[model samples]
Target: MAGFRWWFMAVLVVACWMKGVAGQARQQQAPAIWVFGDSLVESGNNNFLRSTARADFYPYGSDYYRGPTGRFSNARTFSDILGDWLGIAAPPPFSDPTAAGNRIMGGVNYASAAGGILDETGQHYGDRYSLNQQVVNFETTLSQLRTMMNPESLNQLLSNSIVVMVFGSNDYINNYLMPNIYATSRTYTPTAFANLLLNRYSRQIEALYSQGLRKFFLPGIGPLGCIPNQLATGQAPPGRCADSVNQMLGPFNEGLRGLVGQFNGGSHPGATFVYGNTYGVFGDILNNPGRYGFTVRDKACCGFGQGQITCVPLETPCFNHDQYVFWDAFHPTQAANGVLAQRAYSGTTNDCFPMNVQQLAQVRPM
Candidate 1:
């Protein structure tokens, strides 16, 4: 009887190990990539909306894929490239009819153009979905996910899934520094305003966490002041970026880093929050364009005027987008976005604190 019991235990252990290895392989091959944010990742979500901030038009997606796709870039957005890297089919936008069914199991992009950390931040853009609204949208998707799988299975899937939040640019670009508005600037200092954004950001992360999201990747804001639009509008000496706006990003990124650390250090089991130092990575690209095979990191490859506006329909794009960084007035070209996404996924701790996105996907809580 003792010998029979021992044999049974050994078989059970081997079977469990095989199951675990199979699960790991499945996760490595197809970890769901849930994205929630703003223009940097809108995909096709904003297409159904009657918003001026949408990118569902010509010349916007000329570099890759079909027309529009509701992405703000001239080609594949960072998230699209990232999905490819992760070995999963690119997630359809939440608003895309194709994503209406069980196709959502592949993940979804709830990002909207002009969406920001604050509700009021993107209001001027007309019908832009705020971060809170994005969370609400996510909840709707979660309901659908629940219907598709058993509760236990759904919980396990969500626990193993990855959530990405990319925002903050519009909060500054359209809200605080919109020239005459002076709302945020007058009400709070840079540091104070950063705290406010960070506070809201914490809530956003917590909101997602409450939904069983376990892995999080928060991409920090890039150097907004150096973007073509800011450079064109600001009083910076020729060829110099608007330092004031860029300076504001520092406090926000610092706050984000701390927030991630806090979450990781807390008692939340299976929770992994990573901060991708996009600000630093972008700055590196700007400072050393040649290292990334770029000649022009300043001007927009698809916009009209000297970095004054974005790519308009029928308007001409640059002869070679690969040589430039900025695709429009605000977004990065596909080439630049590719570099940024690669870094966020697997770069050193300097680029993605705690861990990069790839590491975040593989981690299983002890």
Candidate 2:
């Protein structure tokens, strides 16, 4: 009986060891999320910047657990919701003092409020990180990571990881459309401007690829004309969106989609580019708010008036924030963000071309 007992103990030890190995493998398979963009996904990077465009005050994050963590939404941003679905913790902002060491293993958010693809897009706001600058910051994070991890291991980590980019809206809303302030409108036609943006954007993506990054989730610009800020301009008839403003987005979005195809079909090995149809999904939500359980789709829930699109600091927002679509002049409420994230994560090809985020997350790097 002693011999039998010894054999049983040995078997149990082997079983436990195998289980631990399997668990570790599963943990390693989870992809890290690196987020970059404008106010739509800006976690708290803008707070660290001396910029006029910031949302570090009350009523901004009223629904967030850590209230007012500088997220532009009334609660979580689209990246936050998508992270929950992936079972990965939201990455700390790259500018955060504590976002160093192994903390970056999960990912890093370089998004900033009022940021844009063009360097001069949001200059009036003062000290915003353009897409070029964000990539530069990411390079800094990569340097820190290399110090802790070997080359092969770091390459594997970045190749299998996902990079989320949401840009272009600010280039239009704050740059091209603002003819008085920016020369872009006067310098280029709508089509010419789209081509210019894409040319610069292609270089940025190539820079990321050169750094060993692979998977990319690029969400296109939404319908800015439908937002309260544009609506307040009275460019459109009553209860209608600014058609002229929205029309300008078409060429840019189309060219962006083309960029995805170009990257995927190119010589770039193991590169998986997914274009998210944020415009279609957001426009659908705006047109069919009742289908999404939203009551107010025209105006913002927190701001004082159509002119003052953003919330007044310490102002009490509406109790039924979830019922409204817009949280302020330019940003969506948590409810809208949740719906958008869901569609992008698991929706059809019309929502996310080639594949959804879930499928993108499952793809193994070659």
Candidate 3:
């Protein structure tokens, strides 16, 4: 009976893998969502490594997508919602032992919790993939595509792929502020730091461009000062966003947008890069929760110490996720994610500068 059970399990795994392949066989304009970012889009992708940044436990996936699969959110992530809006499968995390190249033509999420644009920014997490490392992971996926499809087919797939890059918040919070330490805080002024990040960012996107990622949707950081964790950590006044920390994002965002403009008009000619107005969209939501059908915006839906501590597997989250903007100290509720995705997909110039995600997807990259 034991031997029979083991054999049955193997067969089931194989069956599931086959089913995944069939899904990828669907005829679609966009072949995949090759995502590479931070915790906002990760889905159990961190488990394959020995990283302390694992979230494959309970209460993490409370709102949807079955049990916790290492997503940094309590429910679906920004990538998940965006994938749904695009009518493509959310990229499987390359970290999944089962995510063989055969099952990932639709997309794969390589975002990791505690990850940052700079390799050393989120080192406090102990073992998270840096932005550079995530790009390396994409190379692994690219090699697989080379084997699975013809050269023309691979190029076609990649040219149409919507490569999403969401990062930057941790560089300030986790790196500069935490413990009031890290060399970055003392080494560079705000302008220098922003420039530093932008310089490295330009290189990173160029790496993606070399990999044939043409349609780029880069979401900037939201008001990190407004997050419950930031508030609690700083003991700021009730419901007030942090003024000092919030100020940092504007300069960084300017740098990011400028970088995108350069990529579109210069180095990567013909690439369609749309910068998601993440800060604006989320700021409006935070300011007018009632307008968005919410009652709570100050606290997280889950966690202890009134959200100072994030949710553990056994701790009970709030009964209403829709009412809260945050699910934990640093992440948003799936409800907020859905709203953000909708805006990013089709919202006008105010929501996505230059063009929206849908527009980027529909048009050809040079």
Best by TM-score: 2
Q: Go through the candidates in order and give each one's C-alpha lDDT.
A: 0.84, 0.89, 0.81
Q: What tens-digit string does per-residue lDDT give for candidate 1 at 1-366?
A: 999999999999999997874454344444588999999988877788878887777788887658777888888898877776666667888887768676888788999987888998867768877899889988999988877889988887788877888988888988988747648888888899999999988887888888898988898899998899988885566888888778888999898898889888975677999999999999999999999999997788877735667689877788888898999989998999999988987799999999888887778854
Q: List the pairs of residues colliding in candidate 2.
A: none
After superposition, candidate 1 runs with Cα above 4 Å error? 1-30
What are the runs in model 2 whose C-alpha is more than 4 Å off? 1-29
Off by over 4 Å in 3: 1-29
- Compute the lDDT of residue 135 as modeled in candidate 1: 92
Better of 1 and 2 by lDDT: 2
lDDT of 3 by residue, 179-286 (tens): 455888788888888888888887888898888888999988898888888888664676598878788778889888877777777777667898888999999999
Q: What ranking of all candidate models by TM-score puts the best one first?
A: 2, 1, 3
lDDT of 2 by residue, 341-361 (tens): 889878999999989988898
